[model samples]
Target chain A: MVPNREPVTGRRVQFMISCLCDAFFDDAARAAMDCLERAGCAVTCPSDQTCCGQPAYTSGDWDAYRQVVRHVAHVFHGDEPIVVASGSCATAMFHEAPIAFEGQADLPEIRRLASRTWELTDFLVNGLGVRAWSGRLPARIAVHDGCHTRGTPTIRAVRALLGGIDGLEVLAFPDQDQCCGFGGVFSISHPHISAAMGRQKVDNVRSVSPDFVVSADLSCLMHQQGIAGRQNREYPVRYVAQVLRDAAGGPA
Target chain B: MSRQALDAFAAGIESEVLEAIEIGARSGVDKRLATLTEDYADADALRRLAGQVRQHTLDHLDEYLASAEERLTSHGAQVHFAASPDRALEMILDIVRASGTRVITKSKSMASEELDLTRRLTEEGFEPVETDLGEFVVQLDGDRPSHIVKPIIHKNRRDVARSFERCGLGDYDDDPETITRRARAYMRDKFLDARVTMTGANFISAESGRVAVVTNEGNARFGLAAADVHIVLAGIDKVIPRDRDLALLLSLLIRSATGQRITSYVELVAGPRLADRPSGPREMHVIFLDANRSSVVGSDMAPILRCIRCGACMNACPVYRLSSGHAYRGVYPGPMGAVLGPLLAGNEGFAAVADLARASTFCGACRDVCPVDIPIPDLLARLRARSVREGVILARAGVPSMAGYLLLARHPRLWRLAMGLGRVLDWLPLRRLPLASIRAWFDSRTLPRWRGAQFRKDVKRGRREQEDG
Candidate 1:
């Protein structure tokens, strides 16, 4: 494990924009980059990078999973810290990729990447040592910890970052630790059960009735928001990057 | 036996059943955490120690099985080995047929559920009565147990009352205390009249050959004491190396299962009645059922054999809590069942229940709550890979498309082109496109119009602005 580094300005970091964020919510992706830049990091998006192979891996298609992860490892090969926008995708790269290439000759490179990788919130709070934001946002928000981030350091980082913003009332709802059921391939394969879980999570969110629902992983929020939308209800979900950036007086 | 089974169960499940399951499962999770944290100063360390003990036993299981057989045989108990469920049923049937009476009483046992013991016994013209209160209700209603520990978790008091009334045990009464009194009175008669008793061993010690059965109801003790023959049917995975190991194993089991310091009855039977003993079974038979467990012992699925059947995983699982156990379409349900079902089906039968592996959201809740720390999500993923290798048709119709997506992902240019194409096709009715997964997504959620790689464009533009400045 790499020891914690001192708070260095202009820390060169490679940003691995998750494919989900790139396609569905590009503005949020841009917001993530802005937040990183605001925290004094020089961010570079690897142009050839596309995904972390989580969808293929979680679906049990190892052939496809290995191929995509191998391509990603080559694309993001560097000594700099790798920041990911989604916790699940970060877990796929940092945790799953190395295990997938356990005995292969590329194991060293996979291990190196895994060692330097960080989820965006973890990088912002731990890597840069940014505690309190420069601006404020007065809105009640419910934070959804993605399943991959649950019981991980990323959750604590999420809480610290969200709690740092001035005037943001961070609320936790019932069964907050439960998954939103957007488990990559699971949402597609077991749609009915997935929707049922999502509906339950949305109900929990409604119980709290926060002004906005924010999550570190947009995949979960996407599923929850979709379920809410289906029922003609407005969930008003936002990515953590968007929340932090907008709260810190960065670009909307 | 595929996703169709899961779909049918989910679609047909009553709202009342779902509510009952969620409420029951949530309370189980809450009580388990509360007890573990409050009772044990270092609960996690104990759990880890128990896991190591179980893993060690599985590692040297051949030796322990032999030792256990030798110990039990020397204690004057006849020991039988069954390689399959059919052979187990045959041995059990043979024992019961010669017991001099038609009535057999049984305690709550998941192993029996695996064998469908009661149904088979009914087919063979011998009466097998479920003695445990929950199991009795399940038997009377002809419903499969949805949760391992709580047999009727999916059923409410009304369902139990209706089933009880229909079975002529009593009239329609939904009172919880009334139900318990009627069940206790009813089982008392069965226990007295039963000539043969069958019980499942929670843990069988190789050192002492003692079969430890823990129950809150104390039904196993009563049934075994009154019966002429006590037949123990246990899976080979239940054997541990020493009697002392039960201290930690039992603690983990009870705490994880029911949040109790100890069950009301911990019946430890070494052998049958001797000249010194007054009221125990005259003849005792221990049947160690392999039922494909031997093949699983040294395989990649070996870790799952350490499970203590606590049902903590099911209680923590979001998918299981929502879909209920019946959706799993097997005796085992929840995250544990997702891995166990496919592996137990053997390679030839893998295709039938392969979809169970995909039933989880990989939330890691089950793994966290598991007493033995079985990596259920990883096992589920392993099963999925096995399914892919064996060419089993999965509920995931998106498999082929996923392959195509990977192909596009491998080539950055094609991926960029697809992203751009997605924007153009955003207005098209892709939801009506006949793809099941796509239709499923569109049914509940709508995606925003694609920004055509806006992040990538912004990063490049930012670099240009920086260089120029």
Candidate 2:
């Protein structure tokens, strides 16, 4: 009963649809599924998913992080690799999950899960070597490199995939790696600094003068979009999956 | 000075600092943190070591204080323990009274700022001069420091030149060396003629009972050596376990602060005068001021005592770079200052600077650059929570508006409708808000636009269609 399953063309793969994407941003997850399946890959959505424990780890709450990591590791315990849609979630799995179970006997399982985890773009570019999408969209797009993605190797892969799309003019932002300042609850807790950092990011996007700002993480996009609406500004925001899907003549 | 005067000075500094950070960001100076963090091993190890040392010093502060005093007295230096700021001031006044001293020169000391010592000295008919170049500029201009390390960082060379001319120091030139030499000539006579010299201790080694002073300029050495009486003022927390601890701190201090291996001079003074030395102070007095630091000691906030006053956090702070130190309206400024000010002053209003705590991007740059590895952001969060609990926020209208917004945000249906309407209204010309009303929002950048489709709605529709298929 896999939803949005086109025939698996190239290879069979598994994915963990992040809770945010499953419940709130289902369209983006579906768009990504359509793109991946059309490009010949079987996708699986794990049902026992909750959160990546980023919220807990970031807050310095080690106890909450321990519980979340234990649950996530057990749910995705198979030998086959698991892919995630959100850059932030994937980053948490790879970076923080191992650190959470540092001295426990279950450390090996946590380490294995960390190694096997990948963001969607990482899976596509590194796992499948599908650099160019067989789809096309024409628009001037500004790409925001999520803070977790900037220093990692996967950002280059995402850039490579975007570059391979014909007629897609990818504009560069000044401080592209700077956090959108939407650090989970950070925005609400310290609104002034969060707003200041967001304004800086928005200004960077304006300088590039793109039709829409795109990123892999929907949380950042949501924050930037909300600020844009409240302030009555005019540059739209979207996820890279939606942009890539639209370019492929699929639903945005 | 009155609180009103201080507030005006702080507001002016805040504006200047904000302008500077914006300029730095535009010029791309903020990108250095990434490479800098990579160069240092995870500072967690150093942070833990510093924390443990500070806790030990603070828990047994009385014992350490007695030990430090006994050792200093044995080495021919007098020890004075000031239980309060008034007692500290009276002790210095008593020395002035006994010696009939009318002129004094000082090296940069936050303790002097804490006691408002200069103002008190002047009121009592004694002239106190600031000999540090940055301190001299601020003294000449009659302005408080805009930063702890770079007191006049907000002031351009032209401002210094004008200040110099106003001081009757002859014509003003904006060159750095020229300004320095001008201050030097003015302070040289004061240094030589000074009846007493006062300085702040960087670190007091309990093992050796030697006070360590690290300075770029030789003002501390000159002031202490040339004066007839030398006085050292320090907080109780400034005492560390041993010289090795001082060495570790000194190594981290210079490198983290100005990116230097060490300052020009590292002076370790154990007594009044050295027999082998050609010249030195005749009488040495050490004042260990407790004030409110005892309250911080052995408490959750004690880790802040690990600070060596290196000003590394100030240099790395984007907010400090923008607002400078004056905006904080405290003796200290920057990330460390934001935490230290309220605790020392014993006034909740001083905690208003925690408003600036909301100014950081939580980029972790300050914590990363911190040689001692103070969990600055975590401390900031605690301060913000404290501010909310005290009801000081009600005094500011901004907090209520934020609270209202948060209430609306909690309701999903209302939030979505408001966002939908906001998207439509944003396209209308009348909907554009005044830049000043939302100046804080648009100061560095414009707002992004609301794209037409609701992401949640689109996602739900996609899910429903797939389910039907």
Q: For this target, which candidate reaches the highest TM-score against the unseen true structure?
A: 1
Interface DockQ of each model:
0.59, 0.11
In model 1, the clashing pairs are none
Q: Please give each candidate's TM-score.
A: 0.94, 0.70
Over the stretch B246-284, how does candidate 2's per-residue lDDT look in tens digits?
A: 766776666655555578988889888767644678888
Error of 1 at B420 (Å): 2.0
- Among these predictions, the greatest DockQ belongs to 1
Could you give candidate 1's per-residue lDDT for residues B1-469 as a string of tens digits? 2233575568678889999999999998998999999988988788778888998999999999999999999887999999988899999988988887788999998888889999999899988899889999988988899899999999999999999899998899999999999999988888899999999999999998999999999899999889999999999999999999999999889999988889999999999998776668999999998877888888777889999999999999988877899888887899888888877777677798997888778889998888987878878888887787677775444443476888789999998888777786578797788777677777877666677787777778888998999
Question: What is the fnat of model 2 with respect to the true interface contacts?
Answer: 0.04
- Candidate 1 chain A has its poorest 10 consecutive residues by lDDT at A1-10
Model 1 alpha-carbon drift over 4 Å, by segment: A1-10, A102-105, A126-135, A249-252, B1-4, B275-279, B394-400
